[model samples]
Target: MATIAHHPATGAEPAALRLGAGLMALAGVAFIGYAVIFFVRNFTGGFLELGIGPNEVDVGRAQVLAFSPELFRYMSHLHIALSGFIASTGLATAALAWFGVRHGLWWAYVTAIVVPVLALIIALPAHYPYHLATVGHLGLIYVATGIFVAGALVALKPMLQARHT
Candidate 1:
């Protein structure tokens, strides 16, 4: 007779990890969506119309000239890179958290908590120039990201406690 051995890490996943996985997945999707929007707005002829509009202070202020090949190229690359980073991070966090590894748990927790903070800081500087558009965009993106992060953090609490003990 053969018996199956139980493995703690590979057992039925914990509820926290499950929830964290879902949230991270959602965040990843959101980041991808944002990235696509950014790409459409900047790279193609879509231009400021889709975003803050050409006449917006950020555009008119001459911070970065619209239609400048260099500027658009830079923005395009930046948005694409950000999208890739966020989506990959979210997916990785979800998978690792699901596996219940200590390092994965910690990574999920850190990514959840840190990304939004950094994003908020970056968004703040744009507020003076972009005003409502900047605030609204930043609020929407970071808030959603924060929610996912909060969920990850909550799920990781047990792991966190284990470390302290």
Candidate 2:
């Protein structure tokens, strides 16, 4: 007799994969929330998060444009956009990886690797200690993304090697 799957929802894998994905999603959501908070808090201010100094110094005073205002504006937008993208990117891949591993999708491993890798490449580098207070905040994003990637590999290694062709 064929052994019945402990979790018919996934297949034969245990509940750990689902939990890991869920945790990753939660972390993503949290990062987005914090980014939003940062954006709002610094809207009237500036990109002091990137070590830019003196909140709201008038332009053309005596400084040598330490950071281009226009460039900072563009970078600020890019940062926000990247935050939102990273927040949502892993949403489906993570869930798919979790359930797919159990369901024998074989592609789950690829999804798991690709999702966080993309996020790391884009978001991790931006996680430098921008402001004095935000060093910890930047650290959080990097560390969280790192954990997600590492956890996915450790938790989903079995199915990433599965033949998908």
Candidate 3:
């Protein structure tokens, strides 16, 4: 029987999950970076700048949008929510891929698959109004998400086999 062995989890097999972790980390960093830049340019003088509107809500988000006035609030919610989930997925995926492969944790693999799928599902609402506009965004969301999830699943191979001979 074939068996897989690790370096006693001495942080040696980090490469085991490197592919998945690396993808996740990269995606997460991108999300965080975009959020920072977006948050900055929203109120300040940048591409995300929005015209001051005589609008007030009890609990309103501070994000800016280039959509219709009626859609502004909803779009803000979508952007923030999508950004949050993407960033979260990225970070968790990195951790999952790294530790899961290193320590042979199936939960990490499962998480890798789950996080993106959930994020994509959450973004489904964006397609209702105008699918054309959201096409690119949705594509990006799923591409990045799918890659990591699929990568993690692929990386599970080495961990699933028995090691005892």
Q: In lDDT terms, which candidate is top?
A: 1
Model 2 scores a C-alpha lDDT of 0.52
Give the per-residue lDDT of model 3 (tens digit) for 2-75. Answer: 33354675635435445645665555555455455444543343332122122322222333343355566565
- Candidate lDDT scores, in order, read 0.55, 0.52, 0.52
lDDT of 2 by residue, 53-152 (tens): 4532344212323557666666667666754665466455556554564454546646755776776676555544443335444666656666666556
* Runs off by more than 4 Å, candidate 3: 1-4, 8-11, 14-16, 33-41, 44-82, 133-136, 162-165
TM-score of 3: 0.57
* Alpha carbon lDDT at 77, candidate 2: 79
Winner by TM-score between candidate 3 and candidate 2: 3
Superposed by TM-score, candidate 1 places the C-alpha of residue 105 at a distance from the truth, in angstroms, of 2.7
How does each model score on TM-score? 0.59, 0.54, 0.57
Of models 1 and 3, which has the larger TM-score? 1
Residue pairs of candidate 1 with colliding backbone atoms: none
Total clashing pairs for each candidate: 0, 1, 0
* Per-residue lDDT of candidate 1, residues 1-165 (tens digit): 211122478765446555665675566566556656755665555544233654453462134554575876676677667666655554554445444332334654565556555665775576566454554455556756786666666566555554565
